[model samples]
Target: MATTTISTTNIIQMTVNDNDYNSHFEGNLLDISADPEAYYRVVLFGYITPIFFLITLAANILIVLVLSRPTMRSPTNLVLLSMAVADLLTLIFPVPWYFYMYTLGYYKFLLYPALSCNLYHVMSEILPTFFHTASIWCTLLLACQRYVYICHPTLAKVWCTNQRVTRTILAIFLLASVHQLLRIMPTIMDDNSIIMNTNNESMINNEPQKACRQVIAKWTTSIENLYFGTYFVFRIVFVHIGPCFLLVIFNVLLYNALKRAEKTRNKLLNKQQSTEQRNGSSGWNKQQQQQQQSDDHQQQRKANRGRDANSTTVMLIVVVTVFLIVEIPLAVATAIHVTENMFTVDIVSDRFLSMTIIFSNFFIIISYPLNFAIYCGMSRAFRETFQQMFLKNLFTIRLTARSSSLNPFISTATTTSTTTNTTTTTTTLSSSNTATATTLTRMKNISSASSKGHY
Candidate 1:
């Protein structure tokens, strides 16, 4: 067997760059994740998060802009606007940093050691709790506002006016700010503090890096103890669970009120019909003279029931349902985890715990971005206005549109048709015509733009 030798030129070109690089690889390349679950988590979240962030940003912007219109200026909408603001804050403030954390901050925190103590941790600790709490409370306020509107009309007109709504929003912001400040005050220390407390203990065990590591305030341990012991439970029970229950109650009451109103309308119509029959043809003129007033009243009631009760009810219900579905899981999980951790229970596997945290985070991320879709699905005015703004090519923006028009969207023109069809002995006129007929047909998207409805 003949062994072929390499050419001198090829050998010279292939000469290895003097490399400790071979030794470096043999030592260890960085492993992003050892666990299968964590690897999957990184891939899953890292892929979809950027898309969600973009959607949330644009949707929230559109919501705010559309709600800025004069027609949308109502108490319920005001509350909804606040909720959108909170959700938008959630998406914008900490979300990008969080995405970074998911992708590389995990490793960076490990490498730098001090990165954990930086503004990133401070924000991660604060914004999620603060904005989520604010958002939940905003949702609860919207449900309550709707309850007032649907269940009590006179009181709603008086109490749930735009001024009152504005005041309530201000109050909510003040309360949320104070509550969140108090909640986060203990968890964070001033990393920017120039005066180092030599008396204070170090953040990590036998670590010299002091930059972003947790500098213990003497009270931090005590605060953490109290938080883990009592506050978390209080939060889960009263703060989280209370809102969920209240939302269901308000929505149920609104539903009942709608059913009652509908029943009342039917009873009135039946009574009117029976009275007409009893009066007979002799009394028809007098009854009809009275019928005009009755019809007017019925039409007014129908309008109120349609505009006031139905679309807004659906909107509120959807918001609350979405909130509950997305947030309740995290709330319940947090409660359980905190309780277990407080009690030093070790029944939870490490994998389970990791998955839980990831999922809870994932749920909220998925939740906040969907308000625009919900509004679009439920509110025709919103959808049409959005169409005017975004889908201008598909739908014309009417220059004459008033802010208060019921459905200023579709242009309608009835087309009359006639054609002559001749048989051997007979001539017949036959015709058929069609358009998309959006305005002439009833819109199925249960919303304010639909002109005729009762609850």
Candidate 2:
């Protein structure tokens, strides 16, 4: 084989052509290398994405800590905890490779030359999608769990146990992993090495040398086409479209349930008020007191249940709503990308597709961290637990340190005051004793004088 000098652009084109895959890979590469809009995307991936990743990592970690607490453990919170873990891993595994590829503008070679290309492929492509799919399924599970709890309280008891939820989460992640493997298994890393020119100055001859080797995927054409064709359709139906559709239905059902519950609660309150007013007008008696107390107790219990259901329903609604807002566009874009090749199709410009994918990905990353905010804002229990786990301990430590620092002065003042009081008390007691003794002696002397006189 002739030693062909492949530039960065040619390497990307050759890789795609070699795989014969229908992807936006070529368009994205071209956009980043030649398009004007790619500067913003570079800035976003380089600077903004890392910031979001850190925030998301920290937030999800805190969420995991809070939700995993013994007190915070519930079926719903367990789902949230699983989701946080998924989100955390989704960013963690791919970010280093992504940073190296995009931030450093080194898309041609592996960051570590010694690592196997297959492992790099999994890290760069497979794991992020796998974990993100897990997160998506977890979100769907959360919505369904809440819907069952608020809408069908009886069924929720049987269906939404902690053990059952745990099993379901495991199933979700297992299925997601299997699905990603299916997507990735058809393509293997190419065994033949391709020379990549670094375009750097040579120390000896000042000539560009083939110093780097690039890893590419080898695809059996018929198998690759059939597999991806099926995989894309499956992904569209199960991964993107199915979840979004179910979430919408669940949201609608939940919203209606919430409204009905609110109206029923209002009616109960009105009836309770009317009954109390009538009893007050009639008269106050022993029987009336007992009846009123019973009514008050019953109504209070109902009110509390209603309030809890309403708040939780509202919070889940916000969560699903945010997910839908971010996911729907990405789903549509993904569908289009699967349907049309940007290189061949003129309906959507390559630049537009590139920008769309970039923006969609950015928003998806942004969405991961927003859940922490939603939980804090809407769920009082989550907020309280978070404070107790993180903030409260920090504050307590600061207060303890302050008190410890001040303890010496405080002890000194207390000791000095105590010593003065002790000395003063002793002196007073001594003076009283002395006076009594003197008085007793004088009385004795007088008695003696009187006796002598009489004799």
Candidate 3:
């Protein structure tokens, strides 16, 4: 979630009262401000939001691991891998910062003054925005790649190469970094100087005075106006709105292409079945039969690849859809807040805006972890690969160990039974060997006849 930094100059001008800062720091979006309801809401969010972040962190980690596997690597999966990495970074710094900020309150500055203030502004705000921007663009790239692959197959071969995808992802990260730097440049952290309390001369003379401080983070007014007035509008249009619009267009094209592909596959399947029935009655020769079987096998493999690709495309569409559902409201709210100056308005408007931002943030965080579930639910290859990576090998090891432990008992039982029926076993083995040899000779003669027929 993006946040506008509020000036703290007024807060700094206020006299030190009760040895504490009088106002919230800059970039502090959730202003509870003694409101019982807002405070409780924040407390609730502080406690519950971490759980969501943890889940998102874990899920994105799994996504990275699975997509990084050699067997799973593809242009599409590589793009997804980049997204998972971005999501992972999105939560890594912010979760702890959020926990400290909300649960412990803004007094963190008093304890670790400069560290807390700088980290709060940078980690909790800027870093997440940077990575999230990358993630959004990555989703857009996935949609575009799928659209081209499904709608224009010939072009997909040239455009969707793994190297090109990697370069595109890098370019996205670079652009996001540059954008973040522009947003960060206007905002600066104030020197949090520790001050000694000297209210009482007697206390000052007797012992070391107690220390108090306030950390300020604010933007230069000129630069701030320039950014919020112009570049911010550009950001909303291109970064948030443009990608979403293009994703919708691509998704529609992909869905139509999917329908067409399905129709074509059905037609081909029916044709193949009719041809097989005709050949069955006509008695095809060995060479012709072998050639037909080879062609069918190749066709089946091609069809399976196509099906897997289509399934992945559908899964990506759902991911992009969910992203839009969660993001559009936030984008609209942000645009309103920016245009109407919602934060600087009346108390009721400010409170409503804060709540809107918080809830929108909640939904956005929830959306990050959902891609894992979508991949598991929709893509057969993803499920199979996940099972192979996490489930199958573990089970195979246990089963193998269990079978090994029972092997001695089974071997002993077999030896005793063999000892009791030694003569009968020998006679049976001899007859079996003779039958196998006769069968092998008959198969050899048939193979020779088939080879001669081919020649």
Clashes of each: 1, 0, 0
Off by over 4 Å in 3: 1-37, 40-44, 105-112, 191-224, 277-291, 342-348, 400-455
The local distance difference test score of model 3 is 0.73
Residue-by-residue lDDT tens digits, candidate 3, 207-306:
4322223332344443555656676787778777788788889888888888998999999999999999998999999999999999999999999998
lDDT values, one for every candidate: 0.62, 0.75, 0.73
- What digit string (tens of lDDT, one per residue) describes model 1 on residues 310-373? 8768777877887788767666667667767788887667567667767867777777767888
Residue 301, candidate 1: C-alpha displacement in angstroms: 5.5
Winner on TM-score between 2 and 3 is 2
lDDT of 1: 0.62
Highest-TM-score candidate: 2
Which of the two, 1 or 2, has more TM-score?
2
RMSD values for the candidates in order, in angstroms, are 17.5, 11.0, 8.8
User: For residues 239-292, could you state the per-residue lDDT of candidate 2 as single tens digits?
Assistant: 898999999999999999988988988888899889889887888898878978
The CA-based lDDT of model 2 is what?
Answer: 0.75
Candidate 3 lDDT score at position 91: 77
| TM-score against truth, every candidate | 0.67, 0.79, 0.73
Candidate 2, which segments miss by more than 4 Å at Cα?
1-38, 104-119, 191-220, 341-346, 412-455
